[model samples]
Target chain A: MFEKLDPLLHSQLRLAVMSLLVGVKEAEFNYIKEKTGATAGNLSVQLNKLKDADYISITKEIVGSYPRTTCKVLPKGRKAFSEYVNALSSYIHPNGNE
Target chain B: MNDAQKQLEMIHEMMNKSQREFQSASFYYLFWGWLVFISALVHYLLLTQTNFTHPYAVWATMPIAGIISGIYAAKQQKSSKVKTYIDEAIGSLWLIVAFAFFGLIAMAPALGIDKVYPFLILLYGIGTATTGKITGFKLLYISGLLTFPLAVASAYMNFDNQLLVLALAIFISYIIPGHLLKKKELQMANSDA
Candidate 1:
Protein backbone atom coordinates (compact mmCIF):
# COMPACT_ATOMS: atom_id res chain seq x y z
CA MET A 1 0.00 0.00 0.00
CA PHE A 2 2.66 2.47 -1.04
CA GLU A 3 2.00 5.29 -3.48
CA LYS A 4 4.60 5.95 -6.12
CA LEU A 5 6.91 8.93 -5.85
CA ASP A 6 6.96 11.32 -8.82
CA PRO A 7 9.82 9.85 -10.83
CA LEU A 8 10.60 13.27 -12.30
CA LEU A 9 11.40 14.53 -8.80
CA HIS A 10 12.87 11.34 -7.32
CA SER A 11 16.38 12.02 -8.56
CA GLN A 12 18.68 13.67 -6.03
CA LEU A 13 19.73 16.76 -8.01
CA ARG A 14 16.28 17.45 -9.46
CA LEU A 15 14.66 16.92 -6.09
CA ALA A 16 17.16 19.26 -4.55
CA VAL A 17 16.24 21.92 -7.09
CA MET A 18 12.51 21.49 -6.46
CA SER A 19 12.93 21.53 -2.69
CA LEU A 20 15.01 24.69 -2.81
CA LEU A 21 12.65 26.36 -5.28
CA VAL A 22 9.56 25.57 -3.22
CA GLY A 23 11.05 27.65 -0.45
CA VAL A 24 11.37 30.84 -2.51
CA LYS A 25 9.25 32.84 -4.94
CA GLU A 26 12.13 32.96 -7.42
CA ALA A 27 15.90 32.51 -7.51
CA GLU A 28 18.61 33.36 -9.97
CA PHE A 29 20.23 30.57 -11.98
CA ASN A 30 23.56 31.27 -10.34
CA TYR A 31 21.96 31.18 -6.91
CA ILE A 32 20.50 27.75 -7.61
CA LYS A 33 23.81 26.52 -8.92
CA GLU A 34 25.58 27.67 -5.77
CA LYS A 35 22.91 26.20 -3.50
CA THR A 36 22.63 22.85 -5.25
CA GLY A 37 26.40 22.44 -5.57
CA ALA A 38 25.95 21.05 -9.07
CA THR A 39 28.07 21.89 -12.10
CA ALA A 40 26.59 24.53 -14.36
CA GLY A 41 26.25 22.26 -17.39
CA ASN A 42 24.59 19.45 -15.43
CA LEU A 43 22.25 21.85 -13.62
CA SER A 44 21.19 23.40 -16.88
CA VAL A 45 20.30 19.98 -18.28
CA GLN A 46 18.30 19.04 -15.18
CA LEU A 47 16.54 22.41 -15.16
CA ASN A 48 15.40 21.79 -18.74
CA LYS A 49 13.89 18.45 -17.77
CA LEU A 50 11.85 20.08 -15.02
CA LYS A 51 10.92 22.96 -17.34
CA ASP A 52 9.69 20.55 -20.00
CA ALA A 53 7.38 18.96 -17.45
CA ASP A 54 5.91 22.38 -16.56
CA TYR A 55 7.40 22.08 -13.10
CA ILE A 56 9.09 25.46 -13.18
CA SER A 57 9.32 28.62 -15.23
CA ILE A 58 12.59 30.17 -16.35
CA THR A 59 12.98 33.82 -17.19
CA LYS A 60 15.87 35.39 -19.08
CA GLU A 61 16.38 39.12 -18.97
CA ILE A 62 19.15 41.68 -19.21
CA VAL A 63 19.90 43.35 -15.91
CA GLY A 64 22.42 46.14 -16.54
CA SER A 65 24.84 44.44 -18.95
CA TYR A 66 24.49 40.87 -17.71
CA PRO A 67 21.90 38.36 -18.93
CA ARG A 68 20.36 36.97 -15.75
CA THR A 69 18.20 33.86 -15.69
CA THR A 70 15.62 33.28 -12.98
CA CYS A 71 13.62 30.19 -12.07
CA LYS A 72 10.32 29.88 -10.23
CA VAL A 73 8.35 26.82 -9.21
CA LEU A 74 4.89 26.49 -10.77
CA PRO A 75 1.76 25.13 -9.04
CA LYS A 76 2.03 21.79 -10.80
CA GLY A 77 5.59 21.42 -9.56
CA ARG A 78 4.59 22.28 -5.99
CA LYS A 79 1.80 19.74 -6.05
CA ALA A 80 4.10 17.07 -7.35
CA PHE A 81 6.64 17.89 -4.68
CA SER A 82 4.04 17.67 -1.94
CA GLU A 83 2.84 14.34 -3.25
CA TYR A 84 6.35 13.05 -3.49
CA VAL A 85 7.00 13.96 0.11
CA ASN A 86 3.85 12.18 1.18
CA ALA A 87 4.88 9.05 -0.65
CA LEU A 88 8.31 9.14 0.92
CA SER A 89 6.79 9.63 4.34
CA SER A 90 4.42 6.73 3.85
CA TYR A 91 7.28 4.48 2.81
CA ILE A 92 9.46 5.52 5.71
CA HIS A 93 6.80 5.25 8.38
CA PRO A 94 4.31 2.67 7.23
CA ASN A 95 2.74 2.39 10.68
CA GLY A 96 3.18 6.14 11.23
CA ASN A 97 6.23 5.68 13.49
CA GLU A 98 9.83 6.81 13.03
CA MET B 1 18.42 3.06 5.34
CA ASN B 2 16.29 2.31 2.32
CA ASP B 3 16.15 4.42 -0.85
CA ALA B 4 12.99 6.13 0.42
CA GLN B 5 14.72 7.05 3.67
CA LYS B 6 17.74 8.41 1.83
CA GLN B 7 15.55 10.55 -0.44
CA LEU B 8 13.63 11.88 2.53
CA GLU B 9 16.84 12.93 4.24
CA MET B 10 18.10 14.61 1.07
CA ILE B 11 14.85 16.55 0.76
CA HIS B 12 15.17 17.73 4.32
CA GLU B 13 18.73 18.84 3.74
CA MET B 14 17.95 20.74 0.57
CA MET B 15 14.96 22.50 2.13
CA ASN B 16 16.99 23.48 5.14
CA LYS B 17 19.76 24.76 2.91
CA SER B 18 17.33 27.00 1.04
CA GLN B 19 15.63 28.32 4.16
CA ARG B 20 17.22 31.73 4.38
CA GLU B 21 17.48 34.35 7.05
CA PHE B 22 15.97 37.76 6.32
CA GLN B 23 18.05 40.31 4.47
CA SER B 24 18.96 43.37 6.50
CA ALA B 25 17.14 46.28 4.83
CA SER B 26 18.36 48.63 7.54
CA PHE B 27 20.34 50.58 4.96
CA TYR B 28 17.28 52.41 3.61
CA TYR B 29 16.09 53.33 7.06
CA LEU B 30 19.51 54.60 8.17
CA PHE B 31 20.21 56.52 4.97
CA TRP B 32 16.83 58.20 4.78
CA GLY B 33 16.71 58.76 8.51
CA TRP B 34 20.03 60.63 8.59
CA LEU B 35 19.12 62.56 5.46
CA VAL B 36 15.75 63.73 6.84
CA PHE B 37 17.17 64.29 10.30
CA ILE B 38 19.95 66.57 9.04
CA SER B 39 17.79 68.32 6.49
CA ALA B 40 15.02 69.08 8.98
CA LEU B 41 17.47 70.41 11.56
CA VAL B 42 19.23 72.53 8.92
CA HIS B 43 15.87 73.85 7.78
CA TYR B 44 14.94 74.79 11.32
CA LEU B 45 18.24 76.63 11.98
CA LEU B 46 18.09 78.51 8.70
CA LEU B 47 14.50 79.55 9.26
CA THR B 48 14.79 80.55 12.93
CA GLN B 49 18.41 81.54 13.57
CA THR B 50 19.72 82.73 10.22
CA ASN B 51 18.45 85.62 8.12
CA PHE B 52 18.65 83.31 5.12
CA THR B 53 16.06 84.32 2.55
CA HIS B 54 16.13 80.92 0.82
CA PRO B 55 15.88 78.71 3.92
CA TYR B 56 13.67 76.35 1.96
CA ALA B 57 16.53 75.72 -0.44
CA VAL B 58 17.74 73.13 2.06
CA TRP B 59 15.13 70.71 0.78
CA ALA B 60 16.67 70.74 -2.70
CA THR B 61 18.73 67.87 -1.33
CA MET B 62 15.76 65.56 -1.93
CA PRO B 63 16.56 64.96 -5.60
CA ILE B 64 20.16 64.15 -4.78
CA ALA B 65 19.14 61.76 -2.05
CA GLY B 66 16.67 60.21 -4.47
CA ILE B 67 19.43 59.64 -7.03
CA ILE B 68 21.66 57.99 -4.44
CA SER B 69 18.78 55.84 -3.16
CA GLY B 70 17.94 54.76 -6.72
CA ILE B 71 21.49 53.70 -7.39
CA TYR B 72 21.70 51.84 -4.09
CA ALA B 73 18.43 50.02 -4.76
CA ALA B 74 19.53 49.05 -8.25
CA LYS B 75 22.72 47.57 -6.87
CA GLN B 76 20.80 45.68 -4.18
CA GLN B 77 18.47 44.26 -6.80
CA LYS B 78 21.38 43.12 -8.92
CA SER B 79 23.14 41.40 -6.03
CA SER B 80 20.04 39.75 -4.59
CA LYS B 81 19.87 36.07 -5.42
CA VAL B 82 16.46 34.99 -4.19
CA LYS B 83 13.34 37.13 -4.40
CA THR B 84 10.89 36.41 -1.62
CA TYR B 85 7.23 37.45 -1.42
CA ILE B 86 8.05 39.82 1.44
CA ASP B 87 10.68 41.58 -0.66
CA GLU B 88 8.20 41.89 -3.51
CA ALA B 89 5.55 43.44 -1.23
CA ILE B 90 7.99 45.87 0.38
CA GLY B 91 9.35 46.83 -3.01
CA SER B 92 5.89 47.67 -4.30
CA LEU B 93 5.06 49.62 -1.14
CA TRP B 94 8.23 51.72 -1.36
CA LEU B 95 7.58 52.36 -5.04
CA ILE B 96 4.25 53.90 -4.13
CA VAL B 97 5.86 55.88 -1.32
CA ALA B 98 8.47 57.30 -3.69
CA PHE B 99 5.80 58.48 -6.06
CA ALA B 100 3.77 59.98 -3.22
CA PHE B 101 6.86 61.71 -1.83
CA PHE B 102 7.66 63.49 -5.11
CA GLY B 103 4.00 64.35 -5.50
CA LEU B 104 4.00 66.01 -2.07
CA ILE B 105 7.20 67.93 -2.87
CA ALA B 106 5.77 69.17 -6.16
CA MET B 107 2.67 70.43 -4.36
CA ALA B 108 4.69 72.02 -1.53
CA PRO B 109 4.65 75.41 -3.25
CA ALA B 110 0.86 75.34 -3.46
CA LEU B 111 0.35 73.67 -0.07
CA GLY B 112 2.99 75.78 1.65
CA ILE B 113 6.07 74.32 3.41
CA ASP B 114 4.16 74.55 6.67
CA LYS B 115 1.52 72.21 5.25
CA VAL B 116 4.04 69.78 3.77
CA TYR B 117 5.68 68.64 7.04
CA PRO B 118 2.57 66.98 8.43
CA PHE B 119 1.88 65.13 5.19
CA LEU B 120 5.49 63.98 5.02
CA ILE B 121 5.25 62.65 8.55
CA LEU B 122 2.05 60.83 7.64
CA LEU B 123 3.77 59.29 4.65
CA TYR B 124 6.63 58.15 6.88
CA GLY B 125 4.22 56.43 9.25
CA ILE B 126 2.43 54.69 6.41
CA GLY B 127 5.64 53.47 4.81
CA THR B 128 7.31 52.40 8.07
CA ALA B 129 4.32 50.64 9.64
CA THR B 130 3.47 48.84 6.42
CA THR B 131 7.06 47.77 5.96
CA GLY B 132 7.34 46.63 9.57
CA LYS B 133 4.16 44.62 9.36
CA ILE B 134 5.20 43.09 6.07
CA THR B 135 8.63 42.16 7.37
CA GLY B 136 7.23 40.92 10.70
CA PHE B 137 9.53 43.26 12.58
CA LYS B 138 7.67 44.39 15.71
CA LEU B 139 9.88 47.34 16.59
CA LEU B 140 9.55 48.83 13.12
CA TYR B 141 5.76 48.54 12.93
CA ILE B 142 5.28 49.87 16.47
CA SER B 143 7.49 52.91 15.90
CA GLY B 144 5.93 53.41 12.51
CA LEU B 145 2.37 53.50 13.84
CA LEU B 146 3.47 55.78 16.68
CA THR B 147 4.33 58.47 14.10
CA PHE B 148 0.65 59.01 13.24
CA PRO B 149 -0.03 61.18 16.30
CA LEU B 150 3.27 62.96 15.73
CA ALA B 151 2.05 63.90 12.25
CA VAL B 152 -1.20 65.32 13.61
CA ALA B 153 0.66 67.30 16.26
CA SER B 154 3.10 68.65 13.68
CA ALA B 155 0.20 70.00 11.63
CA TYR B 156 -0.85 72.25 14.51
CA MET B 157 2.65 73.61 15.26
CA ASN B 158 4.47 76.44 13.53
CA PHE B 159 6.86 75.65 10.65
CA ASP B 160 10.06 75.96 12.71
CA ASN B 161 8.82 73.76 15.54
CA GLN B 162 7.40 71.31 13.06
CA LEU B 163 10.94 70.64 11.91
CA LEU B 164 11.82 69.60 15.45
CA VAL B 165 8.82 67.27 15.56
CA LEU B 166 9.87 65.80 12.21
CA ALA B 167 13.39 65.19 13.52
CA LEU B 168 12.03 63.49 16.64
CA ALA B 169 9.78 61.26 14.59
CA ILE B 170 12.63 60.28 12.30
CA PHE B 171 14.78 59.53 15.31
CA ILE B 172 12.25 57.14 16.85
CA SER B 173 10.80 55.54 13.75
CA TYR B 174 13.79 55.23 11.49
CA ILE B 175 17.14 55.77 13.19
CA ILE B 176 16.56 53.76 16.33
CA PRO B 177 14.83 50.95 14.54
CA GLY B 178 17.44 51.00 11.80
CA HIS B 179 20.25 50.51 14.31
CA LEU B 180 18.40 47.78 16.16
CA LEU B 181 17.72 46.00 12.91
CA LYS B 182 21.37 46.20 12.00
CA LYS B 183 22.30 44.85 15.39
CA LYS B 184 19.90 41.96 14.96
CA GLU B 185 21.40 41.21 11.57
CA LEU B 186 24.87 41.10 13.04
CA GLN B 187 23.78 38.79 15.82
CA MET B 188 22.04 36.49 13.38
CA ALA B 189 25.05 36.40 11.10
CA ASN B 190 27.31 35.56 14.00
CA SER B 191 25.04 32.79 15.17
CA ASP B 192 24.78 31.41 11.66
CA ALA B 193 28.53 31.38 11.20
Candidate 2:
Protein backbone atom coordinates (compact mmCIF):
# COMPACT_ATOMS: atom_id res chain seq x y z
CA MET A 1 0.00 0.00 0.00
CA PHE A 2 2.77 2.41 0.94
CA GLU A 3 4.76 1.48 -2.14
CA LYS A 4 1.96 2.78 -4.35
CA LEU A 5 1.96 6.18 -2.61
CA ASP A 6 4.12 8.95 -4.03
CA PRO A 7 7.37 9.11 -2.13
CA LEU A 8 7.33 12.91 -2.32
CA LEU A 9 3.93 13.08 -0.62
CA HIS A 10 4.56 10.16 1.74
CA SER A 11 5.82 12.29 4.62
CA GLN A 12 3.34 13.53 7.22
CA LEU A 13 4.06 17.27 7.01
CA ARG A 14 4.69 17.34 3.30
CA LEU A 15 1.53 15.32 2.73
CA ALA A 16 -0.43 17.77 4.81
CA VAL A 17 1.01 20.71 2.88
CA MET A 18 0.23 19.17 -0.50
CA SER A 19 -3.27 18.14 0.60
CA LEU A 20 -4.04 21.71 1.66
CA LEU A 21 -2.37 23.15 -1.43
CA VAL A 22 -4.35 20.90 -3.77
CA GLY A 23 -7.61 22.24 -2.42
CA VAL A 24 -6.43 25.83 -2.56
CA LYS A 25 -5.56 27.40 -5.90
CA GLU A 26 -2.53 28.83 -4.17
CA ALA A 27 -1.42 29.25 -0.58
CA GLU A 28 1.11 31.45 1.11
CA PHE A 29 4.19 30.04 2.79
CA ASN A 30 2.94 31.23 6.15
CA TYR A 31 -0.45 29.65 5.54
CA ILE A 32 1.12 26.24 5.00
CA LYS A 33 3.46 26.77 7.92
CA GLU A 34 0.64 27.78 10.25
CA LYS A 35 -1.59 24.94 9.15
CA THR A 36 1.11 22.27 9.50
CA GLY A 37 2.54 23.73 12.77
CA ALA A 38 6.04 23.09 11.46
CA THR A 39 9.04 25.29 12.08
CA ALA A 40 10.30 27.46 9.26
CA GLY A 41 13.42 25.33 8.77
CA ASN A 42 11.46 22.08 8.57
CA LEU A 43 8.85 23.60 6.26
CA SER A 44 11.55 24.99 3.99
CA VAL A 45 13.25 21.59 3.76
CA GLN A 46 10.00 19.80 2.90
CA LEU A 47 9.04 22.47 0.37
CA ASN A 48 12.39 22.10 -1.33
CA LYS A 49 11.85 18.35 -1.53
CA LEU A 50 8.47 18.87 -3.15
CA LYS A 51 9.92 21.43 -5.55
CA ASP A 52 12.65 19.00 -6.52
CA ALA A 53 10.03 16.33 -7.25
CA ASP A 54 8.10 18.78 -9.44
CA TYR A 55 4.97 18.03 -7.45
CA ILE A 56 4.45 21.66 -6.45
CA SER A 57 5.36 24.99 -7.99
CA ILE A 58 6.59 27.76 -5.74
CA THR A 59 6.72 31.39 -6.77
CA LYS A 60 8.48 34.15 -4.82
CA GLU A 61 7.28 37.73 -5.28
CA ILE A 62 6.87 40.96 -3.35
CA VAL A 63 3.57 41.78 -1.78
CA GLY A 64 3.06 45.11 0.00
CA SER A 65 6.79 45.74 -0.22
CA TYR A 66 7.50 42.45 1.51
CA PRO A 67 8.82 39.20 0.04
CA ARG A 68 6.24 36.42 -0.25
CA THR A 69 6.48 32.79 -1.27
CA THR A 70 3.35 31.09 -2.53
CA CYS A 71 2.78 27.46 -3.41
CA LYS A 72 0.42 25.77 -5.86
CA VAL A 73 -0.01 22.05 -6.49
CA LEU A 74 0.37 21.04 -10.11
CA PRO A 75 -1.92 18.62 -11.97
CA LYS A 76 0.56 15.82 -11.43
CA GLY A 77 0.49 16.64 -7.74
CA ARG A 78 -3.28 16.38 -7.68
CA LYS A 79 -3.21 13.00 -9.38
CA ALA A 80 -0.50 11.80 -7.01
CA PHE A 81 -2.47 13.00 -4.01
CA SER A 82 -5.59 11.19 -5.14
CA GLU A 83 -3.63 8.05 -5.79
CA TYR A 84 -1.88 8.35 -2.46
CA VAL A 85 -5.23 8.69 -0.74
CA ASN A 86 -6.67 5.70 -2.52
CA ALA A 87 -3.65 3.56 -1.68
CA LEU A 88 -3.64 4.73 1.93
CA SER A 89 -7.25 3.68 2.41
CA SER A 90 -6.31 0.08 1.65
CA TYR A 91 -3.97 0.09 4.60
CA ILE A 92 -6.54 1.63 6.95
CA HIS A 93 -9.12 -1.04 6.12
CA PRO A 94 -7.13 -4.01 5.03
CA ASN A 95 -8.60 -6.54 2.63
CA GLY A 96 -8.37 -10.33 3.03
CA ASN A 97 -7.27 -9.90 6.64
CA GLU A 98 -10.69 -10.41 8.19
CA MET B 1 15.27 -4.61 0.66
CA ASN B 2 18.25 -2.36 1.53
CA ASP B 3 18.37 -0.29 4.72
CA ALA B 4 17.15 2.78 2.80
CA GLN B 5 14.17 0.83 1.44
CA LYS B 6 13.35 -0.41 4.93
CA GLN B 7 13.54 3.17 6.27
CA LEU B 8 11.20 4.36 3.54
CA GLU B 9 8.70 1.63 4.37
CA MET B 10 8.84 2.52 8.04
CA ILE B 11 8.23 6.17 7.27
CA HIS B 12 5.27 5.26 5.11
CA GLU B 13 3.90 3.21 7.98
CA MET B 14 4.36 6.10 10.38
CA MET B 15 2.69 8.53 8.00
CA ASN B 16 -0.24 6.23 7.54
CA LYS B 17 -0.53 5.84 11.29
CA SER B 18 -0.85 9.61 11.70
CA GLN B 19 -3.02 10.19 8.67
CA ARG B 20 -6.16 10.03 10.79
CA GLU B 21 -5.14 13.29 12.47
CA PHE B 22 -4.91 15.55 9.40
CA GLN B 23 -7.44 18.35 9.16
CA SER B 24 -7.84 21.18 6.65
CA ALA B 25 -10.18 23.72 4.99
CA SER B 26 -11.27 21.43 2.18
CA PHE B 27 -12.89 19.01 4.59
CA TYR B 28 -14.76 21.78 6.39
CA TYR B 29 -16.05 23.49 3.27
CA LEU B 30 -17.35 20.25 1.78
CA PHE B 31 -18.90 19.28 5.12
CA TRP B 32 -20.68 22.62 5.39
CA GLY B 33 -21.97 22.45 1.81
CA TRP B 34 -23.42 19.00 2.44
CA LEU B 35 -25.13 20.28 5.55
CA VAL B 36 -26.57 23.25 3.69
CA PHE B 37 -27.83 21.03 0.90
CA ILE B 38 -29.74 18.80 3.31
CA SER B 39 -31.17 21.62 5.42
CA ALA B 40 -32.19 23.69 2.42
CA LEU B 41 -34.02 20.76 0.88
CA VAL B 42 -35.99 20.22 4.07
CA HIS B 43 -36.72 23.92 4.36
CA TYR B 44 -37.97 24.10 0.79
CA LEU B 45 -40.25 21.11 1.18
CA LEU B 46 -41.81 22.31 4.42
CA LEU B 47 -42.16 25.92 3.29
CA THR B 48 -43.73 25.00 -0.01
CA GLN B 49 -46.25 22.55 1.43
CA THR B 50 -47.15 23.70 4.97
CA ASN B 51 -46.86 27.45 4.72
CA PHE B 52 -49.64 29.93 3.93
CA THR B 53 -51.61 29.84 0.68
CA HIS B 54 -49.76 32.85 -0.74
CA PRO B 55 -46.31 32.35 -2.24
CA TYR B 56 -45.01 35.40 -0.33
CA ALA B 57 -44.81 33.27 2.79
CA VAL B 58 -41.63 31.56 1.63
CA TRP B 59 -40.16 34.63 -0.02
CA ALA B 60 -38.81 35.85 3.30
CA THR B 61 -36.31 33.01 3.44
CA MET B 62 -35.07 33.56 -0.10
CA PRO B 63 -32.67 36.46 0.45
CA ILE B 64 -31.46 34.98 3.69
CA ALA B 65 -30.61 31.64 2.11
CA GLY B 66 -29.06 33.29 -0.93
CA ILE B 67 -26.72 35.29 1.29
CA ILE B 68 -25.77 32.18 3.20
CA SER B 69 -25.04 30.24 0.01
CA GLY B 70 -23.01 33.13 -1.40
CA ILE B 71 -20.86 33.24 1.71
CA TYR B 72 -20.40 29.48 1.50
CA ALA B 73 -19.40 29.72 -2.15
CA ALA B 74 -16.85 32.42 -1.43
CA LYS B 75 -15.35 30.32 1.33
CA GLN B 76 -15.25 27.20 -0.85
CA GLN B 77 -13.65 29.12 -3.72
CA LYS B 78 -10.86 30.24 -1.44
CA SER B 79 -9.90 26.66 -0.71
CA SER B 80 -10.41 24.96 -4.10
CA LYS B 81 -9.08 26.80 -7.12
CA VAL B 82 -9.99 24.06 -9.55
CA LYS B 83 -13.49 24.46 -10.92
CA THR B 84 -15.05 21.10 -10.15
CA TYR B 85 -18.39 20.08 -11.61
CA ILE B 86 -19.84 19.75 -8.13
CA ASP B 87 -19.48 23.45 -7.27
CA GLU B 88 -20.84 24.51 -10.63
CA ALA B 89 -24.08 22.57 -10.16
CA ILE B 90 -24.45 23.66 -6.57
CA GLY B 91 -23.99 27.33 -7.48
CA SER B 92 -26.53 27.12 -10.28
CA LEU B 93 -29.03 25.41 -8.04
CA TRP B 94 -28.52 28.05 -5.40
CA LEU B 95 -29.29 30.83 -7.87
CA ILE B 96 -32.38 29.06 -9.19
CA VAL B 97 -33.74 28.62 -5.70
CA ALA B 98 -32.99 32.22 -4.85
CA PHE B 99 -34.76 33.48 -7.95
CA ALA B 100 -37.71 31.17 -7.31
CA PHE B 101 -38.04 32.58 -3.85
CA PHE B 102 -38.22 36.13 -5.21
CA GLY B 103 -40.62 35.02 -7.91
CA LEU B 104 -43.02 33.58 -5.40
CA ILE B 105 -42.83 36.76 -3.38
CA ALA B 106 -43.59 38.97 -6.39
CA MET B 107 -46.38 36.72 -7.63
CA ALA B 108 -48.29 36.94 -4.35
CA PRO B 109 -48.81 40.71 -4.49
CA ALA B 110 -52.14 40.43 -6.41
CA LEU B 111 -51.03 43.53 -8.33
CA GLY B 112 -52.39 42.00 -11.58
CA ILE B 113 -48.78 41.60 -12.81
CA ASP B 114 -48.38 37.92 -13.57
CA LYS B 115 -45.22 38.88 -15.38
CA VAL B 116 -43.35 38.90 -12.07
CA TYR B 117 -42.73 35.15 -12.05
CA PRO B 118 -41.75 35.28 -15.71
CA PHE B 119 -39.24 38.02 -14.96
CA LEU B 120 -37.84 35.95 -12.14
CA ILE B 121 -37.44 33.02 -14.52
CA LEU B 122 -35.62 35.28 -16.91
CA LEU B 123 -33.33 36.28 -14.06
CA TYR B 124 -32.67 32.62 -13.34
CA GLY B 125 -31.89 32.09 -17.02
CA ILE B 126 -29.31 34.86 -16.95
CA GLY B 127 -27.86 33.41 -13.77
CA THR B 128 -27.42 30.01 -15.43
CA ALA B 129 -25.70 31.62 -18.38
CA THR B 130 -23.30 33.51 -16.17
CA THR B 131 -22.61 30.48 -13.98
CA GLY B 132 -21.97 28.38 -17.08
CA LYS B 133 -19.45 30.92 -18.31
CA ILE B 134 -17.66 31.13 -15.00
CA THR B 135 -17.57 27.35 -14.41
CA GLY B 136 -17.34 26.14 -18.02
CA PHE B 137 -20.56 24.16 -17.74
CA LYS B 138 -22.01 23.89 -21.24
CA LEU B 139 -25.22 22.32 -19.97
CA LEU B 140 -25.96 25.40 -17.87
CA TYR B 141 -25.90 27.64 -20.93
CA ILE B 142 -28.14 25.23 -22.80
CA SER B 143 -30.58 25.19 -19.91
CA GLY B 144 -30.56 28.99 -19.79
CA LEU B 145 -31.36 29.30 -23.48
CA LEU B 146 -34.27 26.88 -23.19
CA THR B 147 -35.84 28.69 -20.23
CA PHE B 148 -35.33 32.36 -21.15
CA PRO B 149 -37.70 32.52 -24.10
CA LEU B 150 -40.28 30.35 -22.40
CA ALA B 151 -40.22 32.69 -19.43
CA VAL B 152 -40.71 35.66 -21.73
CA ALA B 153 -43.65 33.98 -23.47
CA SER B 154 -45.26 33.06 -20.17
CA ALA B 155 -45.26 36.73 -19.22
CA TYR B 156 -47.07 37.81 -22.39
CA MET B 157 -49.89 35.23 -22.32
CA ASN B 158 -52.05 34.56 -19.30
CA PHE B 159 -52.31 30.80 -19.17
CA ASP B 160 -54.48 28.76 -16.83
CA ASN B 161 -51.58 26.47 -15.98
CA GLN B 162 -49.15 29.22 -15.07
CA LEU B 163 -48.06 27.52 -11.83
CA LEU B 164 -47.45 24.26 -13.70
CA VAL B 165 -45.39 26.09 -16.28
CA LEU B 166 -43.20 27.67 -13.62
CA ALA B 167 -42.76 24.33 -11.89
CA LEU B 168 -41.78 22.67 -15.14
CA ALA B 169 -39.25 25.40 -15.87
CA ILE B 170 -37.57 24.92 -12.49
CA PHE B 171 -37.58 21.15 -12.81
CA ILE B 172 -36.10 21.14 -16.27
CA SER B 173 -33.77 24.11 -16.07
CA TYR B 174 -32.35 23.67 -12.58
CA ILE B 175 -33.17 20.37 -10.90
CA ILE B 176 -32.47 18.09 -13.83
CA PRO B 177 -29.28 19.83 -14.78
CA GLY B 178 -28.10 19.74 -11.17
CA HIS B 179 -28.59 15.98 -11.00
CA LEU B 180 -26.89 15.44 -14.34
CA LEU B 181 -23.83 17.37 -13.26
CA LYS B 182 -23.66 15.33 -10.07
CA LYS B 183 -23.83 12.14 -12.10
CA LYS B 184 -21.10 13.35 -14.37
CA GLU B 185 -18.82 14.01 -11.41
CA LEU B 186 -19.50 10.59 -9.98
CA GLN B 187 -18.73 8.93 -13.29
CA MET B 188 -15.47 10.81 -13.63
CA ALA B 189 -14.38 9.81 -10.17
CA ASN B 190 -15.23 6.19 -10.86
CA SER B 191 -13.33 6.09 -14.11
CA ASP B 192 -10.34 7.71 -12.43
CA ALA B 193 -10.15 4.74 -10.15
What are the C-alpha RMSDs, in order, of all predicted structures? 3.5, 13.0
Native contact fraction per model? 0.82, 0.02
| All candidates: TM-score of chain A | 0.96, 0.88
Worst 10 residues of 1 chain B by lDDT: B15-24
Q: In terms of docking quality, how is candidate 2 classified?
A: incorrect
**Candidate 1, B98-164: lDDT as tens digits:** 8998899789999898898799998998999998988779999999999999999999999889999
TM-scores for all candidates: the values are 0.82, 0.42
Candidate 2: list runs displaced more than 4 Å. Answer: A1-98, B1-55, B78-113, B133-136, B191-193
Q: lDDT values of the candidates?
A: 0.89, 0.60
Query: Per-residue lDDT for A6-88 in model 1, tens only?
Result: 88997889999998899878899998998888999999999999999999999999997999999999999999999999988
Q: What value of lDDT does candidate 1 attain over all alpha carbons? A: 0.89
Q: What residue pairs are clashing in model 1?
A: none
